[model samples]
Target chain A: MQHKPIHIIIVDDHPMVIEGLKTLLSDDKRVLIKNQFMNGTDTLTYLEHNSADIVLLDVNLPDINGVEMVPKILNIRANIGVIGLSTYSEPSIINQMIKKGVKGYLLKNVTGEELVNAITQVHQGDFYFGSEVQKILADSVTQESNDQPKLTRREKHILTLIAEGKTTNNIAEELFISPLTVETHRRNLMQKLEVPNAASLIKVAVEKHLI
Target chain B: MQHKPIHIIIVDDHPMVIEGLKTLLSDDKRVLIKNQFMNGTDTLTYLEHNSADIVLLDVNLPDINGVEMVPKILNIRANIGVIGLSTYSEPSIINQMIKKGVKGYLLKNVTGEELVNAITQVHQGDFYFGSEVQKILADSVTQESNDQPKLTRREKHILTLIAEGKTTNNIAEELFISPLTVETHRRNLMQKLEVPNAASLIKVAVEKHLI
Candidate 1:
């Protein structure tokens, strides 16, 4: 079960984060702190002549952006598994980092045990996103693909008026249109939005953010 | 200056966080961790008879919310200084914690040095909000008090139309209102929003999230 320790370089702008990670991973003896950097430029410079098994990269760096640093790091050392470390788990940023080729992502509040687990898993060439990250990813997918029903400009205006509890006659008077035309628009809105009545139409419109 | 160690108890559900905190503060002789709890209920029970100078409380607890735990802990021990800790520094949550009588606030990514400073300051009856926290507080203040100009329903609708680059006549045709009435609405939008022209109106409207 024993093997050579996973040499990992910590790339973060915060000194305490590096120290904390070093302290957290120290006792395990499975991962060794090969080096540390305060910014992306220095980390990339260090990586040019040296090599490590993994790079624990931070999202915020003074010299270089974390998302951009991933491909650059891989461009220099393709075998080094890059695990992103950040204080926040923004879905767009995580997705961008993944697209640029990070092996794992972790929130900075990571426990010592999970840090070691992530390092071990990534060292084994398997992708690992922490539980919170996975949850955020799942939430983003559900939220983005929620199928927001589209409505036209006039339909949107009518929807807003309907949400305001306007009668068809009142809406016709306000828009200077015939009451029959207003009722037709209302019926079209219900059909387009797949709702049964005015109440459901307004509810679905709000849910889909059409108004 | 040598003095009696500040007896403190940590309330966090994560064991590794407790261990990491213990490791961080162990080197400092000025503080002593009396005990640790995985939830708020046990911490409160422990404080019923036993006393600690401070409680390093996490925001998320299985049994009790971190903000609610503050007053509860102080109900049992009024003199205990509670320092709120969390992975994220949500402005409203931080503001609520402050309003609830937390003496200090620190992000869980706190450095050992800042952590000791927070404990010492809170122990001495002074407030200590970490630098990142101060920035977020400042941002929330600027964001909330930005003096958003409230617009009525029709005004908001006109604002959206203007943002879509619709001319006064075009909007008049669409809304079935006279061009002169549309012109008055456009001018009213500019004056009410305090912008000089349509471009500025759209810019401010977007900034204020009116459209």
Candidate 2:
């Protein structure tokens, strides 16, 4: 019996990582490395006209943020599966990538077998989060959920967008509001939560189950 | 003439990771897996009775913290090389592990070639940090060296201990101070840095090049 190899596009900022991924998948005939890109811009450009079964997208790219890149890739190719990759696994980043529509998430240290398994599962229209990634996400859920203060509906929406890795301009543009208004909402959220920055705000939100 | 293979022990809570590592290195004749342990205690006990050329230890273990495991391993066998492993790459953890005498550090996603190279390099008494780990450490160094207030030498020492993933009790014991004094120092450090937790304190300290 013959099976079509799952086509994969590897996107990472580091040349060695791309090379390593290629080497890891070289012997596996089940998944084919159809193309590779060093940054997000080239990957987006490639996906505009071409398509692949799965995209191994790095979370940190020189050009575009990996979380934001998910939607852009999906906007162009609705059916394509994006599997997030990164050296460090921040629960917020992984959770944000998933909320934004990644079919799978993997740490950069993924074994070849796990890589193939993730690609195969994602290509079959299922989710595949690597074991470590699963543990991180699970840990996030088990954190002591605290009783929290309430926010206005608009503020909550903005907080979600913020947690989703949106820039002020991106959120404003998406919500059809002014950037200044978005900034004000952000400030209010911080003040209400008593956090210093967006990262901490998201951390608090995750802890409070507010977002 | 054939050289003797390096004896290696695998320590990770994940059984799959150990199996995958074995499979990855199965074809390579230069190294040998002498034994494997799913927790740090057994690995430590094994080290007491027997020593291997290298120990591939996971950063997270069910029984012990990975970063703290370094000094303990070296205490038992000063000549044996210890290579730190983790699913995600945390710069502080990597830096702390290096400070405590880990010859090499690798993310779990290491390929057979890189893993073997790291082991062989460390076995030869050289340092080997995976490319991604190297990038992360580099980023940590390049963080803005902030112009900040000065800390007393004692405060700085406690800060270093904290960044090395030490607990209040551990710091107190090591520094010959009461745990309450350690708590006071930690609180003062947090107040000076205007951060709420040890993690954030470390982040600011890293950014300021204070640690």
Candidate 3:
């Protein structure tokens, strides 16, 4: 059956990565390289005037975070598929990206065939994941089903600020809350995460993707 | 003239990355893939029994940090070349890897040619850096020559604790110092980093690689 070539856009900050992807996927006859961008801003700008069937988006970009960019990209083109690509297999990041509605997740080391398959799958409205990504997803699912702590929106906000090294006073000033309230939230976060100290609290929060 | 092929080991947690690297470098006649491992412990264990000319070490690993693993790997084989490979171009990580005696640093997106060239250069006892890594190094140097804060060891420890969201009391308890002493050090760190709040202090310190 004859079909239109799937248009794909590559967005990553590293020139070498972009070049490598181009070289790796050039031989695939079923896909057309629509464009390449180095940052989220440029990707968004290109998407405003153009359309693609799939986007291979790096999880970390020089401008905007790839996960944060997913929903924004979707808002611009509701049907375009987004694939999260990164070197990290952190369950937290992978889970977050999936939650943000990426159609697939791939590691940077995916084979040319795997890349093609991922794009093809996503183009056909199926989700794909690299082997390691799949493992992370499976593990995260198991963990979430077990004892994942549910955090309030305010607590999540405070936790992120804390991860950024905000003091209680600074968080209070920024959130327009009392320092005591921030401290209470901090303690509540620690208790909920079951961490003994601030360092362990931050570490656990990061591991659990609470922040 | 035919020369002996360089033996190389790949250490990264991602099975696909290892597979991809094996596939990418398989055709290079001048280099031989001696071994591949998924974590630092296995890499170290392999090094304990065997040796390689170069180790393409990922900065982030599942078991131990790649940077921390560098000296341990070198300890096993002092003459072996260590090349830091990662998705990050963060100056702090790059600078730390280089300082720890890695002969090269390459981003995960490096072209096959660049990867081979980096291995060859490192094998020949020369330092090589990906273009983006070079730019980060250059910018960090410029920034350091300007107003980069000089922090003492104790202060650096305190800064790390603070970034972990530790309060003065928490830090004092952990470090066995008085709360007033911890507060003084915290104030000094903020002053030295020229940040108005703890958040900005950590942000600047991280940007400057002070911690």
Pairs clashing in candidate 1?
none
Q: DockQ of every model listed?
A: 0.10, 0.07, 0.16
lDDT by residue (tens digit), candidate 1, A30-141 = 8889898888888889999999999999898878989899999999999999999887667777877888999999987688889999999999999999999999889978
Ranking of predictions according to DockQ: 3, 1, 2
Window of ten residues with lowest summed lDDT in model 3 chain A: A198-207
Worst 10 residues of 3 chain B by lDDT: B202-211
Worst 10 residues of 2 chain B by lDDT: B143-152
Compared with the true structure, what per-residue lDDT tens digits does model 3 show for residues A1-211? Answer: 9788999998987655676677677788899998998789989989999989999998888789887999999999999999999875777778778889999999876878899999999999999998878887788788664235889999999987886777899899999999999999989998998765555576666556565
lDDT of 2 by residue, A123-182 (tens): 999999999999988887797223366899999999877755568898999999999999
Residue pairs in collision within model 2: A109-B109, A110-B109
The DockQ for candidate 1, computed on C-alphas, is 0.10
User: Which model scores highest in DockQ?
Assistant: 3
Q: Per-residue lDDT for B1-211 in model 1, tens only?
A: 7899999999887655677688789899999999999888899899998999999999988889997999999999999999999876577778879889999999866888999999999999999999999998899798774445667888888777765546778789999999999899888888887755664465455545456
Instruction: Report how closely model 3 matches the true complex, as a DockQ value.
Output: 0.16
Sorted into a CAPRI-style docking class, model 1 comes out as incorrect
- What interface RMSD does every candidate have? 12.4, 10.3, 7.0
Interface RMSD of 1: 12.4
